[model samples]
Target: MSNIKSSKKHAIQSKKNNQFNKSRKSLLRTLIKKVDIAIIQKNKILAQESWKILQPILDRFATKKIIHKNKASRCKSRLYLKIKKIP
Candidate 1:
C-alpha cells in the first residue's frame, strides 16, 4: 500500500516485472533441464538439438540479466562437455 501516486504506480510496475521475470526464469530452467535429460539419456542427437535450442535462450536470458552471464556460460560449457563425452 503506497500513499503517494508515484509510489503506487511504482508498486504496480514492480509486481508486473516480478511476475514476468519469474516466468522467464522458469522457462530458462525448463530449457536447461531438457538439455540435461537428453544428455543423461545418452542421446547425442537429442542432446545436440536441445543444446541448440537452449544455448541462445540462455544467452538471451543472460543478456536480459534474468540469470548471471557467467552462470549461463558455465552451464553451456558443462552441458557441451557432457554431450561431447557421449559416443
Candidate 2:
C-alpha cells in the first residue's frame, strides 16, 4: 500500500502499463507461433504471408522497446531462413 497520494496514482498507472505490455507481448508470441505452425505444416504460401505480417509487428515492438532490437532481428532472420527452406 502506498502512503502518499502520488505514490498511489503511480501504482495504478504502473498496473495499467503492465497489463498493456503483457497483452502486446502475448500478441507478439501468438503471431510468431502462427508463423511457426505454418512452417511446420509445410505451407509455404501461408508461412510467407504470416511472415510478412509478423515483420512489421516485430519492428514496432522493437521500436517501442518492448523487445530488444537484436532479438527482433534475430527472430526475423530465423523465420526468414525457415521460410527459405520451405521448398
Candidate 3:
C-alpha cells in the first residue's frame, strides 16, 4: 500500500514499531494485572510497588502513541482509586 520508496521504508519501520509497541502494551497489561492482584489480595505494599512500576510504563505507552493519552490517565486514576480502597 506504499506509493513511494520512502513510503515503503516507512512501512517497514511501522512494522518494527508495531512489534515494539505491542510488546510494551502487553508488558503494561501484565504490570497492571500485578497491581490489581495485589489490590485484590489487600497487599498494600505490593500494590504500591506495582504502581511505581506501572506509572512510567503507562507514560511511555502514551508517549509512543500505542495507547491514547486519556486512556492512560483513566487507567492510572482507576488503579489508584482501587489501591486507595485496599486495606
Candidate 4:
C-alpha cells in the first residue's frame, strides 16, 4: 500500500531482495548441516570434502555481508576441528 510510485518500486525491490537473501541463508544452513551430518556419521572423507566445499561459500557470504566474518571464521574453525577429531 505504498502511495508514491517510487515507494511502490522500492517495496517490490525489497521483496525481491528479501527472497534472495532468504534463499542464500537457507543454502548456507544446508551446507553447514551437510558437513555436520558427515561428521556425525564419522565419515572422514565425506566430512573433509564437505568442509572444503563449505569454507569458500561461508567466506563469500561473509564478504557479501550476508553473515558476519567472525561468525564465518568461527564456524570454519569448529568444522575444521570436528573434521580433525573424526579420526
Best by TM-score: 1
Model 1: CA > 4 A from native:
none
Judged by TM-score relative to the true structure, which candidate is superior, 3 or 4? 4
RMSD of each: 0.9, 1.0, 1.5, 1.1
Global fold similarity of model 1 (TM-score) = 0.93
Model 2 error, position 68 (Å): 1.6
TM-score of each: 0.93, 0.92, 0.89, 0.90
Predicted structure 3, TM vs. truth: 0.89
User: Best to worst by TM-score, what's the order?
Assistant: 1, 2, 4, 3
Better of 1 and 4 by lDDT: 4
List ranges where model 2 is wrong by over 4 Å: none
Over 1-87, each residue of candidate 4 has an lDDT whose tens digit, in order, gives 879999999999999988998999999999999999999999999999998899999999999988999999999999999899997
Clashes of each: 0, 0, 0, 0
Could you tell me the TM-score of candidate 2? Answer: 0.92
Residue 38: error of model 4 in Å?
Answer: 0.9
lDDT at residue 5 of model 3 (Cα atoms) = 96
lDDT of 3 by residue, 41-67 (tens): 999999999999999989988987899
